[model samples]
Target chain A: MLFVFGHQNPDTDAIASALVYASYLTRTGTPALAYRIGEMNFETPFVLQAAGIEAPPRLPELAEGTAVALVDHNETGQSVSNLAQLNVTHVVDHHKLGDLQTNTPAMLRFEPVGSCGTILLRLYREANLSVEPLEAQLMLSAILSDTLHFRSPTTTEADREAVEFLASVAGIDDVASYAMQMFAAKSDLGDTPAEQILAMDYKEFTFGEGDDAQRWGLGVTETTNPGYVLGRQDELLAAMRRLKDKEGLAGVMLSVVDILEEHNETLVASEQEAAVVLGAFGVQTEASRASLGGMISRKKQLVPALEAYFEQQG
Target chain B: MLFVFGHQNPDTDAIASALVYASYLTRTGTPALAYRIGEMNFETPFVLQAAGIEAPPRLPELAEGTAVALVDHNETGQSVSNLAQLNVTHVVDHHKLGDLQTNTPAMLRFEPVGSCGTILLRLYREANLSVEPLEAQLMLSAILSDTLHFRSPTTTEADREAVEFLASVAGIDDVASYAMQMFAAKSDLGDTPAEQILAMDYKEFTFGEGDDAQRWGLGVTETTNPGYVLGRQDELLAAMRRLKDKEGLAGVMLSVVDILEEHNETLVASEQEAAVVLGAFGVQTEASRASLGGMISRKKQLVPALEAYFEQQG
Candidate 1:
């Protein structure tokens, strides 16, 4: 059976797109199983709970020679651990291509759309395949999450169109109300472990390979209050240090974002990385922490600045 | 009107896909013009000639606020020089994303197929649109060129399927025979200027930005006999020096590839870049040139090694 999965950290878009694409492949005569490489985050579980669907099976490992398909992400660094060993048959993603490549030519469906769910919805329409109500709700939740209820800069006319069509099919009249509910669901993290919270939305970038590889990981935690994470400063620092050591990373940073306040306070775990972050974002550092106002999108704002910083170092 | 074009050093796939996508957009109510950013390459012109069509108009400079759509490439460095100012509404390409970003959301249709022509063919079929015999021939030729008639490692099953469908529509029974004829057409470059011939299939990679920017250009000239290019070593070296000076490039290398022999001999223009080329490809140099056995693909073989070299340098 062909296994379909998304990136690590398992965002709502990642989960929903894997389900949708796996279903599409199976319906089109390919036997496939949807899986998740990591644990579901707070928002993704909310999507599943709202849709009353079972979570896709968590993939611990894949046997050698098993064919796999990737959705929502193409970065091998953020994908399965043994990604190079798997026979990647197809990749359906809406992100930029990373270092991922295949031994053979895989069917690649990469777009710069806001969400992979949007692409899957387009595929359903193109194939004249009708999605069930639950499927529509899953796709709608994914689009809403990735676009921040159409508030993000990444949202496009196609995403808005997909949301409208899926909303109608899923019998949702007030998308704003549903989005508020989802946002409210994401607000609770009082008792969660600091490491789990950090791991909820972590990404890594490796500049080199082999003996000269330099990797850095960035974790983002979005909530209604940044104070929640700030209160656990000691625990968060310990968690970041542990992750850096465990992953053999060059550095680590955690960006605690206040979604309602539209601000982010990043805490750098190392002095060298703190310099890089301060130079990149042009912010003042107070004890390895800096405030960035109105900077939300990681792919659009944060990644580019960080990339520029590293590139300029050369 | 939307002006659509591809990267510099226009190839058959770039030219044909721009034409096909522009036609699709126009038929679907959006008026569009297909353009090429650079002068036509040898093989691209042959494809247009065989299809009995005139080459697309060359784009010099687009006015500010002009809406543009990019095909075949998405790198701002490789695209129109004034790309940052244009309102990019769409991007349909099969290559890796470069540092191109739009201020507004674009309807991007990027795939990792062998050729952008393959994606355009799929678009035509999905829209229930009919392509003329000449259009089919143009797309067929593009697929053949990009995939090297199914010999390149980038060729996917989707490309093969598209090729079969397009060949039938174009009334060609023997694809091998047609490919041989096209290859024969490409074998003769008797009296072309060394600089012009080198610019025919050139690519650029810019690492940093602003004062710290590092830019390098790579050119590939595939021929049945590399002896012809080797005989003009002085002229080629002068051409490379002129290009490096005019473009303000950090370095430039021209790879003379023998298609039948499946080998490449890269000529370095400067001593600094010569060391880089020698170290990156791990080959012995004769003066300022090195022979790489069985290395034909710039994308698959040369680029990755160069990237590794640059990354390792940091």
Candidate 2:
């Protein structure tokens, strides 16, 4: 028996990717239990129920020989809240490569493309497993969310191609409207605090030279209205500022994207960091980077520039 | 044995969705052959190859007692193209409802949610099947293309939820850039003739008043760099008008859209049709109905408006 896991505060991509992976593995005669570290949100349950799929039991009873294959997020020794005593043997994630594990007989596949769901799709093919609809819908959802409804630069040729196929099988013709509604649903920040909204779908970035380590947790929060992007900038900035002051190295930016307008607002940690980076890209901005036609997702859209800036700084 | 089939001039959504369905069928115990009536273009190959999947065989030798499934587009009366003699036991698609045989013993599952792949995903789940990677990727791609990367208003809640789930399993944190690039790849129309470029993705829309049956084919041709959109509009319009005059469409509006800008120029045979239909949706016009955000897809985006206008005309 083996276990499939994802990170805490898991997003739609994480949850759905894990479930699909588990389903694929089992269909291929691979015994595995797909589980999450924390409770799945309302959006996840709705997605699974509608697709007629269910999330596997969370952290179910594991045998001594159980091997864990983590999905979406990796355990970088910074936290062990969920698996305090458990052991992970393999990992499948689609985030920036971290110093996850060097000694464990595990594999880490990280690419610049959008969702881990895509990676799982690759694995399914490599394993020669046939696809079923529950897993298909889950993987499709994961890609849509991670790519921000396919509006992110992190998306790849594979993504577009996959979407074309899925469009036929899913019986959906107006994918844009469906994507809008999903984002709108996730962006509705009712009762949730600014911090919760900010940290809801977050990732950490570590750039520049470091002796020990320097990491900046970056996240993008969406809103129902486009103007809400401006409304939450200050709160998000302050949070980034606190992290900047605390970490004291490199840049940490929060991007507020206007999905419909095809525009973005990148909130930088410091004017100097923005200055250093914008010069590399031939822009001058200290407040928020607002360009109408540029790509949105912070991961693929902004990371290359940030990396180039770090190289320049070096 | 089963076969997966789709409509003519199959768009990315129709083709990709069929691929996913075929993948699902093969992954399970049921083996299927994916077949199409028309041609496959440049961009589609990339998505299929990216996922290491193949489109269905066009004219595979079938055995007796073979079953076929209809997806995305369907036709009757004159013995369908890819499936003339086979037992079409199931019709799983997302299109304007057509004249399906009332007494045929077939499973009919159709929904209007932008992409047919979304419905196939549901069908797979209801049947307790699994969604493997390649199929998942295809379904996800279909959703993006059908939804215009999630910009149309016809997307349903079920479609939205399924896409969210699929993204995770596909395993990318960002998809927008991937979609944009795919669209951009298709957008490069480089000196091609107006008619050929337009046929890159042209579909027949059936509309009529009483006994008068009209079929209008709408398509778009794009170019890169300076004066690209307007420069090609005239030639494109002239070509479409030729079809309009020949086919006797009340109007054939080719909404030339700048993907990055989302602005489109609608070239129509009938100004009143553009006025009554496109105008009702707030599409701006310089010569014909134009809009900054007018959708480009004909499936869910245009059919609704056309149907509504036709209904109102009666």
Model 2 residue A145 CA deviation (Å) reads: 47
Off by over 4 Å in 1: A207-214, A245-248, A270-274, B1-15, B21-47, B50-52, B56-116, B125-137, B140-314
lDDT of each: 0.81, 0.63
Which 10 consecutive positions of candidate 1 chain B have the poorest summed lDDT?
B97-106
Which clashing pairs does model 1 show? Answer: none
Mind listing the fnat for each candidate? 0.10, 0.00
- Please, what are the lDDT tens digits per residue for candidate 2 over residues B1-314? 67777766666676787777776667665687677656665556656776676665664556644677777754452125425446666666655334433212244455556788788787567556767766777887788766656665556776778778777778744778666656766665568787776666766656655566556676654322325645777787787788777877666766666655555556665565566554446664566546535555555456656755665655
What RMSD, rounded to one decimal, does every model reach?
Answer: 8.2, 25.8
Candidate 1 has an fnat equal to 0.10
- Over 4 Å off in model 2, which ranges? A1-314, B60-66, B75-86, B220-229, B270-285, B292-297
Which structure among the candidates has the greatest lDDT?
1
Q: Candidate 2 at B107: error in angstroms?
A: 1.6
- Tens-place lDDT per residue, model 2, A1-314, is 66787776677877887787777667777677677766554456656766876676667655544467778765453223434245555556665434343212233344445788877777666556766666777777778777767677777887776766665566657767767766776666555555565556566656566663445656565444657656766776777777667767456666666666657666666776567546656666745654423656665556556655665666
